[model samples]
Target: SSDVVAGYLDAKWNWSTLVGKVNSSTWKAHSVLSTTDATKNNLVGVFYNPTTTTKGNKVFLLAGSLGELNRSGVQRKRENLGLKLVVGDVREPTGSEPSGRIDWAEPTSPLNESTKTAHQGNLTEFLAAGGSGVLTEDGTLVFPLMAENGNGDVYSMMIYSTDNGSNWALSEYMTFAKCYNPRITEWEGSLLMIVDCENGQRVYESRDKGRTWTEAFGKLLGVWAKPRLVFWDVSLHLD
Candidate 1:
């Protein structure tokens, strides 16, 4: 069953964490996120996206939930989007526990009121891009995020933490409307993001910690060469 690390039902609409033991080739499942909490049930937890990344000996797990919250058995209409993050500490295996262990801290709502306030009320929802985030050489943790502008336009941006996950801040700049699913990485002290926009796929570069992003047209030479020739913008230099 190694091929099948884990599986769940679509009807449940709940997302959980499942870890595999490297030593034994075994798997363990944990329900770190729940949709049935009456206290917070107001926000329906589709738990749509789940992402993970590692920094030193710590592992970070992030997930996003959305939908209307139900209170008093009544489904209230509102934007109940949220992002949750959990940190885990690594420990060596012992005689009692051969597979080692990860001590996970309680999940925190990273995308809270502060996040909305920081965005200046431009975005109505935020979701984690489902995949691994990038850890820069300078030790900054960056994660790609998709957001909806209340007007139904989706934009790709980033949420990053410089102090080793102590606090995270949303990117002040975002891609043009209708761009999403940003994939980010560190290149020469700058963050590069590959995103799919309404017209086509484009690359962007951010040097100021996501504060600003500009089109990276020079990086992919081969891809841009043909387009430039079609427009006759530059002298073609054959390599």
Candidate 2:
């Protein structure tokens, strides 16, 4: 009955938000960083590193600022937002020492603060990176990054590492108008990415251990919805 109830509700609602709510509640505090500005929202990604399991379990969170288009007829300026990575020890109830605080080891790119004259309030776009991170059976960590240029076009970069988080290699660039809310899962010895586009859901898969990706399930129903994949012995579950 619990499974049935969960399945029915998950099919109707955004599954990613539900899991995020659960994690947010149990994780004590919202580990992700947010800005004081009402227009800006934090884009976060969480994943568990298995290869480094012996050393210590690490949870990776990345955040960026999103701009809101002004309602006034005058042109509005976009503020430069920064991306921060917060690493925490998953084994312990709370992170140990600096583990709980926000640490800046590296940023995706420098913040961009510029005004949009042509689009004005029409530009409801936000720039965010790092929301989808998934662990593999072989103890590899894979995640996606959102990169935008001066033209406002969005691109995706898949980053992966075999030797834990010590070194990372970048995959080829993916062309997508607007992409966020990345979810990854390993099915039948392969890695799959469920990415959210402005229109609908797009599924990408990798065979060579996440070096690259090809569209597996093209534009599934409910593209705007974010979904998480989980594997169980009995049945495949979505949450």
Best-matching candidate per TM-score: 1
Per-residue lDDT over 6-82 for candidate 2, one digit per residue giving the tens place of the 0 to 100 score: 01112244878667755663433332333332233432222221111122446554445434444467565555443
Q: Which residue runs does candidate 1 get wrong by more than 4 Å?
A: 1-25, 37-44, 67-79, 219-239
How well does candidate 2 score on lDDT at residue 105? 35
- Looking at candidate 1, what is the lDDT of residue 142? 86
Question: For model 1, what is the alpha-carbon lDDT of residue 69?
Answer: 54
Cand. 1 TM to true fold: 0.73
Position 66, candidate 1: lDDT: 59
